[model samples]
Target: MINQDHFSRLNQYRSMWVLVFFDLPTETRKDRKAAILFRKNLLDDGFSMFQFSIYLRFCASRENAAVHIKRTKSRLPKQGKVCIMQITDKQFGMIELFHGQKETVPETPSQQLELF
Candidate 1:
């Protein structure tokens, strides 16, 4: 028989990864300011820089993911498009990395898994 407590805990381990991708215009003063502000907001909200114009954060659940997405959406610049993706930790682990001479792996989270 399935233990409800064990099952719930195992399910929470799946967790999630929130990826924020954007390409806001940077040619004009206003555009540049908007871009910088967006970056700052992401950092303020706990996202880590994943690459140029890319950021990521770990979300505890679908609701948490929604909150982050809403925050990102509220700050989106007018000149470009931005996308927020939510993926399970298992899927994140499957991502492949390829670069000319650089080695990087998914970050090891410093916080404990959140349960709510």
Candidate 2:
């Protein structure tokens, strides 16, 4: 298990990427309700959106991730799946690899990575 202290340190500069996959049936109304409920819960909990389907990354220390999962599990729609990914080095690398031409300044040490 990840300790609270380590978790805190890790989150100082990085965040956790949460990916939620909706598995609703063909029923349009149920799908809409589930999406609304899911978004509401995340918003109520202060989670931002990174993309249309992906939620914004949060400062999810190991401790926070655990707590977040525990707290949100029950509130999440039953017709969906949740995934948590820790983004530290990889995200930086991707930014550099993709945005290097557009960026004028050099990337930070922490921003250099082989994978995102």
Model 2, 2-78: lDDT tens digits are 99988666655555444443443436888788878877887766556644665543443455555656666777666
Error of 2 at 66 (Å): 1.6
Stretches > 4 Å off in candidate 1: 1-9, 12-14, 101-104, 112-116
Taking the candidates one at a time, how many backbone clashes does each contain? 0, 3
Model 2 scores worst on lDDT over the 10 consecutive residues at 107-116
Clashing pairs in 1: none
Evaluate all candidate structures by whole-model CA lDDT and list the values in order. Answer: 0.83, 0.55
RMSD from true fold, candidate 1: 3.5
Superposed model 2: Cα runs more than 4 Å off: 1-26, 89-116
